[model samples]
Target: MNIEFKKNKLSIALSIALLTNLSLMAEEKSPKELDSVTVIGNENSDYKSKEKVKLNRTKMDIEDTAKSIQSFNENFIEDSQLQNIENIITMSSNTVYNGDNHGRTNDISMRGFSGVPILIDGLKVTNKMAHPEVYNFESIEIQKGPDSLQYGESSPGGIVNLVKKKPTKETLGKIELEVSDNSSYTPKLDVAGSLNKEESLYFRLVSVLKYDEGWTNSNTETNKVFIAPSLSYDVNDNHTLTFMAEYTDETTPSSFGTYVNSKGNLVAPIKNTISNPDEEFEKTQKIIGFDLDSTFDTWNSNFRYRYIDYEGDNGNVHMPQSYNEATNIVSRAFASQKQEFEEHALQYTLNKEIDILEFKNKISLGADYNKAYSKLDMFYDPSTPYLINLSHPSYEHLTSASEHSGVMDMSSDKTYVESWGTFLQDSIYLTNNLIFNAGVRYSESKPKNGQRSDALTPSFGLVYHFSDQTSIYTNYSESFTPNSQEDTSGNILDPEEGKGYEIGIKQKLFDDNLNLTAAIFKIEKENIAELDPDDPTLSKYKASGKQESRGFELDINGNITPNWSIVASYGYTDTKNKDNNNLDLKNIPEHTANIFTSYYLTSFGLPNTYIGGGAKYLGSRYADENNKIKFDSEIIYNATVGYKKGRWRANLSVQNLTDEEYVDGALSSNARGTRVYVGTPRTLLATISYSF
Candidate 1:
């Protein structure tokens, strides 16, 4: 019931900003918080005076570890203006982001599971059917279970890491302007630098551009471009080096077609002016990544590389009553679909920080290699309008007859996959309050057509420290996932294994400006990737060994009162379908929660106005998999208004403030027609910013 009001609205607004930043960092000891952690950071910056973080050193951290996790930082994305990453990734609390006609692609799920796996900076830019974004992030980690030991045949109910954004000597940067009413326009730029002369060389660059006219009718729109650059070097005093690069290209116009279909699926029957699908689905992907690091004293070394290519296409039915219901059965009007992906990977790691015999050690070792390729293309047009009447409930899609007007000529193909890996981890302290962690990973996969998947995953953990504020931890892990790129006659689909358990607790009451964490998790999966009793319609897919999930999480972040702050979260899920306990695992959701608070009246007198609000709850869902059909549960609210001075800032935003229409993502009533994508009905955004 009301999920315990997400823990009394984040423990009473973080017990009043954690007793006012613990009485101002315990007064008289602030050199800007030790000069923002000693003017610079690295070696994960000794975890910056740590409070909770060390999910296997950079697997990711911000709060307590082992399952159920979340973080936003950067003062909750500049006090919630949340510059996209799909709006702070649904503000965690059991993530979900429904809409996807597959343009720039967006479709995710975490507690209820849906191939959830994404990483950047930690690599593995997801894809069994791609969709990635977080537009050059600098922090954003959210996990829940079996974090696939952090991606190894991944996705066991959670994982989303998008770190990027390195290179800092603090020349802090920001610049922006935006407008929306469905006639979008945006421009943003960021810069940072501090080179040589002991600044140890550093650099940062971020850029973005957008154009829109979306909210459709028949010539839809959404265009984008992005660029990023990063570099850091410290060559001596222990040796160090790093370099990174990014590029993005996006084009949108095809928001999936076959227009409106009342009872079979597909909605958005025109209510705005734009493209009605007349055919146009475009996608372009290019990414080059690298990072090399070295340090000596106790040992640490690194290497990572990435390359990706994405492709796209479409013209299918394009609306017009789905081209008059597939051209009345014989003269096909249009149809074509395409998909492609390519990737190359490399990884190397080594770490050691020992105190040996005295009993204090930290060690990690790694190895990796990967090569992948995928492809698909289909077309139709049996006479021009295609042969409809197959129990005609208004059929649609049918074209690509080699380019239209031919009947069944083109159908491309391609698939290749390979992989290798090794890993080991350790972190034991035993005294000073107890600390322990363990790990193991081994993977080997091959796929030309199938067979040859090996795995060895293991993990353990513990962290006590009851007093210096608080602490408690536990972890158990195992993971695997590999298999995709065969189906449609080539076979191959079996490699989805998982096992995980976690318990957590962390607190810093008062001092350290507030931070709390609570977690519970469980995961079980096998084979995964479903549908194939022999011919589940032909595009062929299989791998269902079973599946399972369980969860609980709550997190509240920093600076409760130094000026009022809050970053909330909540999640409770119990996914199923492990050999039909009553089948229903299509869209997932048991209960989800989210809340974000803001306070800072400029010392209360309200100078340059600032106010905040947030609420989100989603439950009751099941729209396929023998559950029949359903999707009735919703709660949403958000509000914000702000003003800042000195470097200039302004804002106004209101989203789904109870004007909710719902359907954060939908599709799967046995598939084939009746597409849907909705969520974002009451929107009004405006922005301005500057910093030099």
Candidate 2:
């Protein structure tokens, strides 16, 4: 069947069902008025948000939900000046910034698991290599542990969801410019307001332009452009419609940094680059989506649809394969690739609050469908090795090479994946201070030219509120990810399965201004694909590997006083491969911690001035699965000062304050241990903004 035709058919069916539900809801009689529910937290001190949107596909209070969820609001994003997803996620407990795939992907890991999926407004986008820009987001939410009941075929670790800024009825505008010591400049604009006299139609526009000269010796430059526009229309008192679109174009240099030598030491200086300076990676992405929300006398419903298109071309790629310390030469491969990805997703959810057997119950049910297509074409000339002398690097390689002296190998792959799932959950209020949460999902996945996989996942939780300021909870959940890889016999492997268990406690402190949470969790995954021991060439694989991760985390956020704001977290993780004599997982730190605090100077007579500072620490980790090579730990510090008065605001930030030289993370490591990444050097940035 034609892809477009199939999509249209599904869309039409979903639309008709939505209309029918709306019609039925309209005829229901009104019920007794319920007490109003108020959202907590204020704009003045909002490092921590009290509510989350994607945890359960509804705006639920964090204290009432029996899950470990962390949220960073707009105030924190602006105060810290975080630009990318990597910077934002590292602040959360048990999360690490894995090496960026040489400017290709925003690689990250949580609880010893990598490749965690990212979502925009509770919808998945298939382009994992494109890093999400944070300029247009209102908040970032991270749900820890398996969440297959809400999102299908996701990593067992967790999921990151970005809530976009929407159009508002009141006029608001802001323009800002920033310059950094590393020869980087950025300009941004945001405007939102009502578009009609009745104040029922609203529009919002957000845009950013960024340019940066290379920070390393290779002088690899970067340029990026991002724009987002959205509209909201109040069709009636009971219904609203919102439409949004986004476009992004970017070009960045690929720097793989240096590798570990035979002596198990870093081969090059922190500022040096091993890749050719002329090579570049280009990417373009576009998204279009719409959402409809309806409220009736007894129930509420939301329908959302999104489509994403992404393309990329990596030119003249260089990958380090091995290093000879005796000659100070690194043997690398010359390669190139192109990739295209597209995704279409639809979701509908309904929620109702009712009295069952004289007890209040909140019921939620939803269904979702997603389809994605991806294609990759690669070219390599490994016979003609590119040798780089670490002592004296050279950038005189071919500017554009389609023909080499050696034989060139080319390959291509195309894949199509479609998945659908339905889930139902309920929160039963057994008593005024106790609650029980249970949910289940039926999920199925079908891949072109691959086997079909299905699973039934269930979750159970209980929350007990000791008082208005204290609570304790425990939960269990399961997740599954379909596998496309085949064995030596051409038989598809079974999907990977995971199960998680967690228990946590929450407490409100300092007049209910600060929220504190501590939790312990254990997760196990089975059927992980690994190389077959009997396959000498290592070209074939089996799906019999098993791994486990156990960890404890502590987090605190919010205000200590009216003028003092803080965010802090610490996590310890232990991961082992059950199939390999309990070896440690590669690139996963055992300990991680972050803390940031800011205070207004009102008491010191500078009412509009503030100062903030923080430090991030990553413990030592192994470079390879065998744990033969270990990388040392490091701490990076940052500080900021800002002044806001009238319509003008100014700020200055210093990153890597002590000019720390350290290995940030690694992408991959073989017996030779290559593809390591270096942390950023000391840099200063200043910004000026005007608001109306």
Best by TM-score: 2
- Superpose all Cα atoms of candidate 2 onto the true structure and report the RMSD in Å to 1 decimal: 9.9
Local distance difference test, candidate 2: 0.80
Per-residue lDDT of model 1, residues 1-692, tens digit only:
45334433443454345335534543545656434332221111011123232233433243323445665654466556554564576677667766564454556777666666666656665442233334356566666666544347776666766666678876655666666788776666666767665788889888766666666544535555667777777776666576766666655666542322323232333333112334455666776666777777778777778877777755464232232234322122454667788888887778887887798767778787878887777655545433333223333433334555455646757887788777777777778677787878878888776677777888787877777778888888777777663565666665677777778887875566666778777777787676666875766776765777777877676656655667777777777787777466766777777777766577767756677878878776666666655667788888887777665677787777667766665543433333445555666778776554
Model 2 clash pairs are none
Local lDDT at 215 for model 1: 62
* TM-score for each predicted model, relative to the true structure: 0.32, 0.91
Runs of candidate 1 exceeding 4 Å displacement: 1-69, 72-141, 144-152, 155-158, 161-179, 184-212, 215-218, 221-252, 255-313, 316-335, 338-377, 380-449, 462-513, 516-556, 566-599, 602-692
TM-score of 2: 0.91
Best by lDDT: 2
